[model samples]
Target: MSSLSTRFWIEAAREEIQDWENECSYCKRAKSKSAIQIMAPLPDIRLDMPMRAFAHTAVDYAGPYITIQGCGKRREKRYLCLFTCLTSRAVHLEMAYGLDTSSFLNAFYRFTSRRGVTVKMNSDNGTNFVGIKGTFEETRY
Candidate 1:
């Protein structure tokens, strides 16, 4: 249909044919022919844990959004420090003033003080986290 339509005098025939081909079911099935299927789902280990909150935790840094300063017409960048319990799936959020180690430590301290010391913590290889981890290691030693 595309080649036949292009042979005629229809305006934008190639673009219309391309659009129709994109939404066509035959094109979709052709595209999925080489796809692979997943064999099985991974094991769920969250059910075997004792009734403890934040025993295993995953921590991540979120965003840097603008916030109003106190009693003044000023906007400052703030980030979210997220702490998630692996077993209970509970989340704790803390505001970070900046992406520095001090701010992250303050948030972490607040979380630990409230939720108790976590047994395990998982985080990505962000630079601020790397610094914080190094500082904690030094203090432990």
Candidate 2:
């Protein structure tokens, strides 16, 4: 269909993609006729832990959902900080006002006050998370 509509043939497009070596790796993978062999999921010992709720926690931030800031016509984007327990599969949600360390700390405070201290936490290298890591380390020391 694309070959009929566009000026170039499908083979030409494939050849063009092959010319860009970086893109061809992905294109070649997509064009392969063989059935995909997916690896089985790896097992984690932490998930099998006999522990209390919110013990082994994983923290991540979601979206910048638009919300009304104050009383009037002012609106602001907010991010949702999600805390989940690996062992119990329990979840806790907190609304963060900003992506800064202070805002993240406020949400962290709210989470800890409600759920208590967590044994382990896993999260991606978001700047907010990285900033607070030093604070947590200092407190521990």
Candidate 3:
């Protein structure tokens, strides 16, 4: 169990323990060993793209930088809405005024107007994104 090959030692220890139950008192315990096995990898689905850029897209929010208004003392936080094409890796960035649904919708509008509607869009599971998910669902129905 103390060997540098932890997996091997673990399997060895497990087998030894199981064998201990069936062994007589006069017999020495057997060591259990594990071997590494190769596994077939899953196919890459991105290769089957529909021959169009931005058809499959991913979105994510970037920042919360503090920025002062034009010649004003007040500071405001800013966020970025990033849109990326899954196939071509083309990227589109839109500034989000805030993390609210309205701000996200505005950014989404700008992106769609420029790049056309996406058949599928992926986003991180952030609360702001979740809010937009509800908005999309509501608009769909």
Candidate 4:
């Protein structure tokens, strides 16, 4: 075998090499010939809805009950709630000692100053919405 040409040795050993590879436990256990591939899903689109058909608003609270760090007033903490319009996605922000009338008014004024007059405004009805007056018609839930 040592005296044979390299080409001849390779040709002669090909069948034995294939047989050894098939019978070897490590090669059989570690090698794989087939695989499955998966793809991610796509987002859905709604064709019927026109963009910015009506002014949409969403309000959410940003904190739990607590006091201001340095003010030293013994009371519940303040919450920062934001109101956003869905159509234009315009935003209004207010910070309140408690979700009270004054805080809502402050946020409303800030929003109105930036976005101008909106025909409709939307927000969740908490105590902030109670007895509240505004120029824009409100749709509260």
Which one wins on lDDT? 1
Question: 1-141 in candidate 1: lDDT tens per residue?
Answer: 656866778878778878987899998777676758986753354444856899888889989889989886999999999999888789999999899989999999899899998777778878888888767777651
RMSD score of candidate 4 (Å): 11.1
3 or 4, greater by TM-score: 3
Supply candidate 4's per-residue lDDT for 78.
Answer: 79
Between which residue pairs do clashes occur in model 2?
A: none
For all predicted structures, in order, the TM-scores are 0.64, 0.65, 0.61, 0.43
For residues 22-138, write the lDDT of model 2, one tens digit per residue.
566776776778889998874473546855788778889999899986785888899999998887678899999999999999998899999888877888879999988779987
By TM-score, the better pick of 1 and 2 is 2
Model 4 misplaced stretches (Cα beyond 4 Å): 1-55, 65-76, 88-92, 133-141
What's the lDDT for residue 92 in model 1?
94
Off by over 4 Å in 3: 1-45, 138-141
Question: lDDT values of the candidates?
Answer: 0.83, 0.82, 0.79, 0.60
User: Model 2 — which ten-residue stretch has the worst lDDT?
Assistant: 42-51
Candidate 3 lDDT? 0.79
* Rank by TM-score (best first): 2, 1, 3, 4
User: What is the per-residue lDDT of model 4 for residues 11-97, given as tens digits with 9 covering 90 to 100?
Assistant: 656676668879998887778567777966532221223345324456666776576465776566777877766654555666655
Better of 2 and 3 by lDDT: 2
Show pairs that collide, candidate 4: 56-86, 66-77
- For candidate 1, give the lDDT: 0.83
